[model samples]
Target chain A: MTAVLEVEDLTVRFYTEEGVVTAVDGLSYRIEAGETFGVVGESGAGKSVAALSVLGLIDSPGRIEGGEVRFEGEDLLSMDESELRSVRGDEVGTVFQDARAALNPVYTVGEQIAETIEHHLGYPPSAARDRAIRLLDRVGIADAETRYSDYPHEFSGGMCQRAAIAMALSCDPELIVADEPTTALDVTVEARILDLLAELADEFDVAVQLVTHDLGVIAGTCDRAMVMYAGEAVETAPIEELYYDPKHPYTAGLMSAIPRVGDDDDRLPTIPGTMPDPIDPPPGCRFHPRCPFAEEACTRTDPALVDPETGEAATLDDDRAAACLEYTEGLSGGLDYSVEVAGGTGEHVEKTIDERDEGGPDE
Target chain B: MSLRRFVVRRALSVVPVLFGVSVITFGLFHLTPGDPVSQLVALNPDVSAAEEARLRERWGLSGPVWRQYLAWLSNVLVGDFGRELRTGRAVSGILWRRLPETIVLGVFGWAFAIAIAIPAGIYAAVNKGRLGDVAARVLALSGVSIPNFWLGLLLILVLSLYLGLFPVLPPSRLPLYHPETLRYLLLPGVTIGTAAAASVTRVMRTSMAEELNEEYVTAARARGLPERTVVFKHVLRNSLVSVVTLAATLTAGIVAGSVVVESVFNWPGLGSEFVRAIDRREVNVVMAITLVTAVAVVLANLLADVLYAVLDPRIRYD
Candidate 1:
């Protein structure tokens, strides 16, 4: 399958009074046509910034320093304002994280959606209004014709998200970048919105770039997942493989942190330390500061993204790649973790590490 | 509540406020150093003591202050604001004659203020941190800092005396729509407008800048709308909600500033008439003008509340 978006060495930086913050450092990923690609990371991991950079929505002080964001083989970075305008809603749409704040409060949701439709699709006002109502109805808004005149505050959080999704789908964009679209929602509503997004993606055959911190969401909705740490992708793999056999220590830590139903562990395992300061990041591997299996080599040398099985540098289309010393056999102190597959293809595996060297009880 | 009900309630609520204002203004003037009777008698030396007493009784100045206030209040309730002591003209008639002029000047000043403020504010906010924004900020600061009367005198000096662009004194007996009348209004209108425009610009700039930072603006831009559309249609519309309140209040302020501006420009408006009446201690005329000004401020606030409801869908009147 052909890729709808090919992001190569994407770098974004923010120039603030404090200093220059490298928000997204040498990030590279791709979304295939008619597939869901997830970018999973903790807060401040630059996931949102990377997504916004794809759409050229980064504001002043935050600059897309370098990289090529080729959408459908067209270089988006080189496009002028007018050209970008034509490509934004017409080709790639974005659904923001906060649904309520994402919608214009003064206008009705119908008017906002219709505005997108009219602008990009060149639909006349009446036709756009009709299309807006139909879109709202398709998104499961009841009595959409009457609700068209209602303002955003009249809708609940879940409803607002649905309306936002409808707006993103207004011009029938080929790709949609949803940044934590369900983070502000409750669990049941999140599920419904996720289901709706998945269904819509299938119906329209659109590529999706789902950015979220929730691994469960990635497991449920995405075909492939890219785990990010400190503005860099630590691992990229198929959903099942990443869940059952994580390669990078950071990815393994993330996988083992999720709570299981039948487990007897009193406390949930957590990755040590927070994200490093972006203004002056640690030298070499960005994750080496918090990584449990870090060696002297990990701190002095940055590892390139490589296929773990083949031990070769991976390209944009690689099926599985991880940036770690163990994959390259350059580590003096090796990762001593073993993955215990729980059961089926979709179940999460537990990573049990030898903790004797770290002062834990010997097992 | 329904819009009609909200409006009626707001209108009904203003009656007590006006009553309190009228009472305070009446008492303050009565209790001040000068006596209206003495001031009038001092001007007319030929009048006998009996004549003075008769005049005092006729004007209801001989009764107890509370009784006099009650008498005046009853007459006002019946739409008889009494007669001016100096001119023997009905106070209501005098107000009716001057009200149009003041309204015209106030409206013109308000329009000028909005015309200058909205664009300047939008420009400053759109080009924040740029040279144009710096210049606009300095202009707004000067506008706010300069006193209206001083600005009026300075304008008259340059535009009237030096440049001969407008008449020093407003042309009398001309209709409001006449070009001559418009030229006459330009100097005073700008003088009063600049003071208010400065404040309006500040408010608009701050509010517009804030709304531009809101997530909806980013969302709108992400939807492929041009920056102009995002700033004007989305950001400006939301920003104007706060600006509406400021604009209405400033419009009322224009009426107040006209009192000083008219004196400097020698323009014939209610402000000048009110100043002259205050100097002569024309209690009836002074009370009438004060009541009118109070009513104007109250009405402007009411209009602001109603506009708030219209502009913000989340605001529901109850």
Candidate 2:
């Protein structure tokens, strides 16, 4: 079966006055139907830009240089504006970072949802309103009927996100692109919103592209995840596999950086340096500057993403891949790392994977 | 608070503002070099002192300034402005006759301003940095920079003297609402409206450009709304919230512009009469016009607050 969304060699750039900034470069990933795929990156990783490119939402001064965004077997890039628009809110709805900002201040929350229903589904205003009210209620908004007419400011941050989720699901789209849906929320509110998003995605049976910087968020939510660095995907694997036996050193660094609840580590380990400037990145691996395991070859050559286990070039069908000289050209010193999962009360048994020797915990 | 309550509160606030204006205006008029009856017959030395005394007493001006001010304020509260010293006609009666002309000019000026500013502003913003936007901006710059009197004279010279498109003076017999009145109104209306329209256009362009970058605009477009609907149906209303505030200021601006504008066009409006009353020290006419204009402008601001609420749901009086 065709994947719900297929992005191949996607490249996006912004033509600023200073020079061209390649925001997203040669990035590719596939999300299967009813799956949650997380795109994890720092601020300048271009994860959001890649997602926006799928819906043709890149405005002027920023252009989708080249890419093939195939949505359910259709190339969304080649479609006309009108055709693309018809598919956008109907087939692939979007939830943005700032929920209140995403919703228009002047319009009522319910009418905003109904507007999409009326536009794409051919439902009359009254019928659309009824459906929208049902959707708001489904998204856990109590008194959805009375709340439908309330503007965005009247809703709390969490409630605004709920209403946004309702609007995204209003047209019953097959794919929902939620870009950091809980970034603006409080920690207490963040958990509830994320759970609500996961629950709704399951209930609706829709694929979600969850873009976030939090590894914990990806750990608890995603089925498969891709790690992006310097506008490129560095690794891709199943969520559990990536967490336990991460193929990329950057991904391994990310795993260890998360503060564990069971163990009392005063200062958590963190990646050494910041991401390289995107406008002019390092010549070799973008992560080489920060990688503790970087060898001479890593600074000399750029490596393509490949299946580390089989030493073959990575494809959308490949189950696991890592873009590193160790996986392709064979590093002189060899890559060594271990992941230890702390078991709280033995419910989640302590498990460790050391790529070099399968050693028990870190010596 | 509800719209009605908001409106009522705003309306009631106008009272104190008007009273303050009345006191200031009365003080300023009294501070002028001459007494009220001086313009009447003070220059006429052939008249006896007793005649002047009797005239001052009859008009109730033979007292200290504060006593006279209290008298004027009391009379004004009951819709009775004192009699004009020159014509002995009721100040209210004189104002009632001349106010319609000023109202007609002001309405036309505002109509022309709004009609021009809204479209031009939208176009300029939608096509920002394009040739059309540059042209509209240049026009707006010229509109703001040019003085109303100079523009008024230029219009008369070009439209009346050269083109003969309109008569040099407003037709005396034509009713203020007549279609022919529109022809006579063009020069003054454009003159009064040019600066306001220009300022409004700049504001509209800025407000719209800012709003277009708002996340909601992108979200609205993401919803598959057509460009026209996204711009007009969604962004336009948000942009107008700020423009409405500027429009309120422009209301007073248009009314004030009429003083000079009415003189240039030789229209028999309160503005020209107001200038005459000022010269002759017709204190009653001056005070009446000042109070009326202050009240009109204050009410205009009230209307703006209401419009702001209508356009933006977030605004609340409470």
- Report the number of the highest-TM-score candidate: 2
Error of 1 at A60 (Å): 0.7
Interface RMSD of every predicted model, in angstroms: 0.7, 0.7
Q: Over 4 Å off in model 1, which ranges? A: A344-363, B1-5, B41-54, B62-67, B170-173
**DockQ scores of all models, one per candidate:** 0.84, 0.80
Summarize candidate 1's per-residue lDDT along B1-318 as a digit string, tens digits.
Answer: 666777678779888888898788779778887677788778889989998889889888888899989988888888899998877889988888888988888888888988999999999998899999999999999999999988888888888899997788754568777877888888888888898899999999999999989999989989999898998899988999989988777867787898998888877889999899988788888889888888898888888888877777777634
Against the true structure, candidate 2 reaches a TM-score of 0.96
Residue lDDT tens for model 1, A1-363? 999999999999999999999999999898999899999999999999999999899999999999999999998998988999898888898999998999999899999999999999899999999999999999999999999988898899999999999999989888999999999999999999999999999998999999999998999999998999889999999999898778888998998899877889999999989999999999889998888778777778889899987889989999799999777864655677777777666676566543235442112
Compared with the true structure, the alpha-carbon lDDT of candidate 1 equals 0.89
Q: Give all TM-scores, in the order shown.
A: 0.94, 0.96
TM-scores of the first chain across all predictions? 0.94, 0.95
Give the docking tier of candidate 2: high
RMSD of each: 2.9, 2.5
